[model samples]
Target chain A: MSLDKADVVKIAHLARIAIDEEMIPEYTNNLSGILELVEQMNAVDTDAVAPMAHPLDMVQRLREDQVSEENQRDKFQEISPKVENGLFLVPQVIE
Target chain B: MEWETVIGLEIHAQLATKSKIFSGASTAYGAEPNTQACAVDLGLPGVLPVLNKEAVAMAVKFGVAIDAEIGKRSVFARKNYFYPDLPKGYQISQFELPIVGLGHLDIELEDGSTKTVGVTRAHLEEDAGKSLHGEFQGMTGIDLNRAGTPLLEIVSEPDMRSAKEAVAYMRKIHSIVTYLGICDGNMQEGSFRCDANVSIRPKGQEEYGTRAELKNINSFRFVEKAINIEVERQIDVLESGGKVVQETRLYDADKDETRSMRSKEEANDYRYFPDPDLLPVEIEDGFIEAARAALPELPDQKKQRYIADFGLPSYDAGVLTADRETALFFEQVVEKSGADAKLCANWVQGELSAALNKDGLEIAQSPVNAEMMSGMMQRMADNTISGKIAKQVFQAMWAGEGDADAVIEAKGLKQITDSGAIETIIDDILANNAAQVEQYRGGNEKVFGFFVGQVMKASQGKANPQQVNELLKSKLQA
Candidate 1:
């Protein structure tokens, strides 16, 4: 139930969170304490109950398939950091 | 030592809906980049997603067509990943519970045998945007126009052992989705795309070998080629005393090779969890029943009906009913022309198919539609035009020269079925070719074909072939 320093480092890498090398031990301890609380909750067996997708017991609302939005490229792009030719430009990402 | 190749396909079929799956943004393609992207699709703050009912209905219809179990309560999960195309840093997809589950499709193999490919599951997911890689000042340009589009990701089990079978299976799925009117099935437009998982093992082995997923195969031909190359690569790896590493590989269609996608491989660990913003979607029995009732005749049913009712050969039936548009066009020709079903099948499978393939046009985009095609067929059936002359009329009709009657009249290509006219042409031919006529009387029955050809040629290929044969026989023997 407890996470080690290596585990914290890997988790931070996966989550795309940047942490200092010296901060790894402190973060690991904090994360392990949170896991301990989760372990206590998991100990309460509820095998008969089904897994829930949401906390609220409500169904999702459905929308009709209609095009009501107009072209707002200028309005939306006003807030972007970098845009060219109506495209949002980001650092080069190749896959 | 023999090796067996195991191939499976994961197809992403964009559902034919007017708007985005969870937003009201227009899902039209080829728009100005970012023009159609709204707040919800851009993942702006304080925005919530509502499911599109049409997409749900379409998915249900697909499940019904495949005779699959439709999940009564499906949950949407967040697939966390980092990509420029994906704006929200995660994609809303189905994790454990998908929309359609445990379906199977029967694909016709090269040997005319049918094999049932198991469809593991089909889940609904939102598509990511496009990242234009080059010529963006050394930066990638993101277009969110494609984001939030609904895609039904259909996964097939590793049941195929060859590339041909895999293509057949992919084609069958394409036909079914298009038949259901759920997906457009346009590969060029990226509406319908496929990724393949390929592995190889020793013959008679129960355990599957390590699989490498092939991505970016956009065409059916490429699908077959990529899988074959990947399988060969795996065999080479194993034969050389090396183990194949499981990774994602890009299919370089230009070089006809697959190279490991190093970056995408490290990002494979997708931590999936249910999206708290969306609750479970519970389907009612009434909705399922409605989808079933509204289901049109699928390809298999239509093919069988063509065999039983129309007396068409199974091969002809299969070719005619390959896709929904082609099947509808064939039926329209039959209904409008009132010609024999066998003849209708021939024209549809022969000239119509050839012209469409030549021009790279779909049946729906044919210049000579069902009405004109059937008109031409009618003329042929009623002996108003000889089969030879009908081809000329068909060509003219295809060139926008008008329908059957108009083209026949315009080009003076009508059949000269009048016995008097045919007899005159035959007399002229017999008189001009006395040497051949003498040879005909000298027991050279093969010379008879020469006389018939001469008569038809004299009549400008307008003489009815059967009439020419009978009249030539009486004259030459006399």
Candidate 2:
């Protein structure tokens, strides 16, 4: 589960974070430490216990399927970096 | 060695809910960009997701229809990835525990043989916004109107052996969802779409080969073509002493080939963990029972009923029940016209379908309705018009000429059942064609057809064929 410098660099690239070459070693150490702690947790023998996903034993709240919102495109698009023809524009992205 | 193609599909059916899955924003299509995106859909600070009961009910309905295990408690997980279309860095979806468990769907292949495809699971997820790449000036445009729309991603086992079987499996799912009234099943609008995982191995290989996923194929035809092309590519690669690389490929339908989009190493990790904002969904027996009770007759059941009750062929039943609107139209025609089932089936499949195809219209968009069609059928039944003249009358009705009665009256297309008028026409025809009559009486029975043609010509094609045959036989015999 230990992450090396190359693994750290790959992770950073996937996350779209521009990290310096010198910072990769430091990230590798920190990420490997976190993974070691997770491995330690995973070492426990609690096979009979049911897996838990939520802290509180509560079910999700349900809402009626009705449209209550009105059009606010002009106001929302005002905060975007770029917009044209009622579309939020970005640097071109190919599939 | 013969190669075998194995395929499994992941279908995303957009649920027909009034609003987004976790927000109050409208989920209606073709809205102005970002207008329908509410605070929750936009991932504003400190926003939490609440499940839509209608969407949950719909998922339950599908589970019950397919006879799947409806999970009493299902956890929602956050699949973390980065993309421009995803306003939130993570999409809320189910991973380990889905709402629907292992199920099966029975699909009828082209050879009229049925096969059961195993359903791995169906999970709920929120859709990302659409990224329009080419429309703008070298810039990508994002439409958030589709953001947070609810989708049921149905995963299937690797049970398909060919492209045709895969298409059949997809079509069965399409019919089922539309029949349940849960999804609109509009592939063009992208309410229904699929990603296909394709692989190929030797004829008797126990283990599957490295698979490639064909992403976001929107139509059934494209699904078949994409899978066929991918299978051919994989076989070719293996035969050339190369291995098929695990990757995501895009089907360029215009080019009729699959090109690599991203390889396994470049693929996103999609680190998945349970969502903290939303709690696990728990269902009660009462809810499941109510959903089951509310379920309509599914496509397979309706197809069986059409075959059993109406005596329709298996193929006709399949075609008629492929869509809900067409089935309802057929039922209405039967109820109104009280016509024979086979005749009704033939007319709907033959004349009506042909006309609809010619005009590029769906049954729902037909200018002539069930009532109008039933009236025409009645005219044909009562010896009022021949089937040939009925088609002409239908064309007239389609041109907005009026109903059956009006069209028949305006065109004087009614059958000539009047015995006295037919007798006069026959006598005039006989007097004019003395040579043909003599030939007929001189043991030349083949000349009877000419006499009948002459009589029909004199009657302007209004003579009832059966009556004309009987009357001409007696006259020629005497």
Candidate 3:
């Protein structure tokens, strides 16, 4: 139920977060404590109950399939860092 | 060692919806870049995703078409990954609880046998945008217009034993989805795409070999070729004292080879968790029933009906029903022409298919519409034009000449059905081919075909073939 230093490092890497090597212990402790709380919550047997997905007892609101949005490309791209030929450009991510 | 190939397909069928899956932005393809991307699709802060009712209904219809168990309490989860195409760091997808489950599709095999492929699940997810790699200098151009498009990712079990079986399975899925009107099933525009997991095991081995997930295979031919090449590569690796590495590979159809997608190797973990922004979608029985009621007759059902009702051969039924549009065109021809269904099936599968393929047009985009096709079929059915001459009339119709009657009149290609005119042509053919007549009377019955051919030729291929046969037989005997 607890995360080790390597686990925290891998988690940080997967999350694309930059964490200092010296701060790994502190982050691991914090993350492990959160996991322990989850463990304590998981200890109670609730097999008969359905898994809750949201805090509020409500289903997802459904929207009708209609095109309500207009052409806001110029307005939206005005805030982007880089754009060319009506495209958002980023570092090469060829895969 | 006899190696047996195992293939399982993961098909991503873009649902035919007007708007995005979770946003109101338009999902139309080929729009101006980023024009259809709204704040929600752009993943702006504080923007929540609302489920599209049509998307859910489409998914439900797909499930019902496949006889799948619709997930009443389906939940969306976050598939965490990092890519520029995915504006959000994580994709909202259904993980532990998918929308559809445990369906099966029976694919017709090469030998006229059927194999039921097990569909593991079909989950709804949003597609990532296109990453134009070489367009920008040291950067990728991203079009977020496709970022939030809804996709039904259908996963199949490793039930296919060959590349042909895999293609058959993909085609069956494509047919069913298009028939349900859930997906357009256009592989070229990437409305329908497939990723195959291919591996090989010994013939008698119960355990499977390590599989390589082949990505970027768009067309059915590429799917089959990719699986076959990947299987060969795996077998090569095994026989050369090396083990096959289980990884995602890219199928370069242009090169006809698969290469390792090394960039994705390190970051393969898609840490999935329940997405809290969206709540559980509780599909009730009433909703499922409505979707089921809205379901069109599926491809398999139509194929079976074509066989049972029309007495079409299994192959013809399969070909005619493989595409919903083609099947609709065939049925319309049958109804309009009042001809035999088998005859309509033949024209649809033979000449119509050839013309459509030659022009690289879909049945919907055919130059000759159903009415025109049925008109020609009616001519052939009512003996107004010989079948051979019908082909000529069809070419004329395809060339924008006119309807069957107009083309027949313009070309003077009406069948020589009048007894007097046909007998004149037959008498001339019989007189000119005195040698052939003697040969036929001398019991060399094969020359009867030559006599019939000569008669038809004299009639400019307009002689009714049955009448030609009868008159020629009686004349030669006398």
Candidate 4:
């Protein structure tokens, strides 16, 4: 349950957040602590116990096949602050 | 120099549930920035979250579709994080016990090789709101309409060895989501997103090399590109005797390069424990059976049936079965028009696909449907409309729906198949192209094309080419 300090630095760089050297030790400690808990989970002997995956076991839910929806144009565009008429307004994209 | 690329994918698909995964607010897209959000989504004091039933159903639906085990009991865990977009300061997700277990899906490689990709597991989680960067002074604007929306994190096994296989697997996943009606399957809409884990090792190496995970690759093409570039980068690093570091990266589509976003960290420290608020979700066998029964025909099975039943080629079956709507449309066209299934596949792939892209419309919005297309194709087969005039009729059919007969009648686009009309046109073409006609008589029979061209021009391209060619040959010989 230990992550190297350098691994913490690499993770921060990959996540694109600038973290100073001071935060690296803290992150490393925290990450290792979490992995410790995860390793504890592995100790439980339950090879016979099936892995529970999804919560729902229903076979199927069928909806009456019908084409019944309108293309909500005005309603969809109403939320955008940058709307020109019916289209989402974006900054001038072309010269 | 023999090496192989190993690729796996982590896909986070926004579920089709009406409400947010844990909140009562509507989980709709394209909504007003902060309006649809409830107090819980806003993270107000003491607002607890309740999981949406639809989301559970959707998760079960996917499990059933893939023939994966439905966890009769599952629990949601809290993933602690601090970000401006995550108002709750933690997302509710499944970590220890996922909702769906391991399953295998088969995909066909481009070179006609088949391989089965392994699905690691699928877990359900709630989404965080978006942070709008680059809006003003680099200050982020938070949009909560998407907050608390349900997402299923599907992790795949590192079974793919090439960029093409990776994409094919992703496409298969996309088809499953769409076919299950569990997601809109819109990659551009941020509804379905992919994070690829890529590594490269020597051709015969058993132990895998350190893998780099790339995030925010939204499109399938970008996923393939990112994987290929990452593969090359890893190869270069190993060749130079430098160790590859495990980190998260972003694919800059403009630069066509991947840059390290951060080092990969095991987030287990989020103190992931089952949320105390929600009880362990218990799914009975009856519930699982119902979800299983609702599974639609998956893409691979549908593709195989199109081959065995419809006599479509493997490639044709692949293209048609890429999407559920496209497959259904092709089948309906084949049924209603009673046209050859092969022709139906061709017309749908050729003309229907072109029109759908040009107009930026979904298959549901197309003016010409499967039946109308089949009708038009059948008419062409019967010589009621030459293939040339069929285009004109097709253009009309796209703008407005009328069968081949009505569209042809309104647009006056019937094929000139009558022998009398064709003969007259052929005679005129022979008179007009006397030089070419004389050449044909003088043993330059290859010049016969000159008469066919003139006949087409005289008949305004409505002349049946086969009929015109035969009539012209006889008249010229006589």
Best model per TM-score = 1
Give TM-score, chain B, model 3.
0.97
- Evaluated at residue B302, the lDDT of candidate 1 is 96
What's the TM-score of every candidate structure?
Answer: 0.97, 0.96, 0.96, 0.82
Model 2's CAPRI class is: high
The numbered model that scores best in DockQ is: 1
Q: In angstroms, how far off is B220's CA in candidate 3?
A: 1.2
Candidate number of the best lDDT: 1
lDDT of 1 by residue, B1-478 (tens): 7999999999999999999999999998899899989998999899999999999999899998888999999999999988888888899999999989989989888788899999999999999999898967679999999999999999999999999999999888999999988999999999999999999999999999999999998999999999989998998899999999989999999999999987623857789999998999999999999999999999999999999999998888888888889889989999999999998888888888898899999888999999998999899999999878888888888888999999898888889989999998888888888898888789889988888877887888999999989888888777
Query: In what order do the candidates fall by TM-score, top score first?
Result: 1, 2, 3, 4
lDDT of 3 by residue, B1-478 (tens): 8999989999999999999999999998898899899999999999999999999999889888888999998999999888888898889999999999889889888998898999999999999888899977899999999998999999999999999999999999899888888899988899999999999998989998899999988998999899989988999999999999888899998899999987632767898888989999889999999888877788888888989999999899899989899998988998899998887887788887898889899889887899998999888888999778888988888889989999999899988888888888888888888888888888899998888878887888988999988988888899
TM-score, candidate number 1: 0.97
DockQ winner, 2 or 3: 3
By lDDT: ranked, best first = 1, 2, 3, 4
Clashing pairs in 2: none
| lDDT, model 3, position B221 | 92
In candidate 1, which residue pairs get closer than 3 Å at backbone N, Cα or C atoms, i.e. clash? none
- Candidate-wise lDDT, in order: 0.91, 0.90, 0.90, 0.80
Cα RMSDs, all models = 1.5, 1.8, 1.9, 7.3
Give the Å error, residue B187, model 4.
1.4
Per-residue lDDT tens digits for candidate 4, residues B1-478, read 7888999999999998777777656666797676666667767678776667778889999988877888877778888766666766678889777889888788998789789888989999988876665553424466667778889999999999999998998899999999989999888789999999999888999999899999898999999999999988888898998999988888999999999875224443475766766667767898889888877888988999999999899999999998999999988888888878887788889888999999898898888977788889889878888777888888888878477889888777778879999998777777777788778889997887767777898888888888887888789999
Q: What is the DockQ of each candidate?
A: 0.86, 0.82, 0.83, 0.06
DockQ, candidate 3, vs. native dimer: 0.83
Q: Which should have the higher lDDT, number 1 or number 2?
A: 1
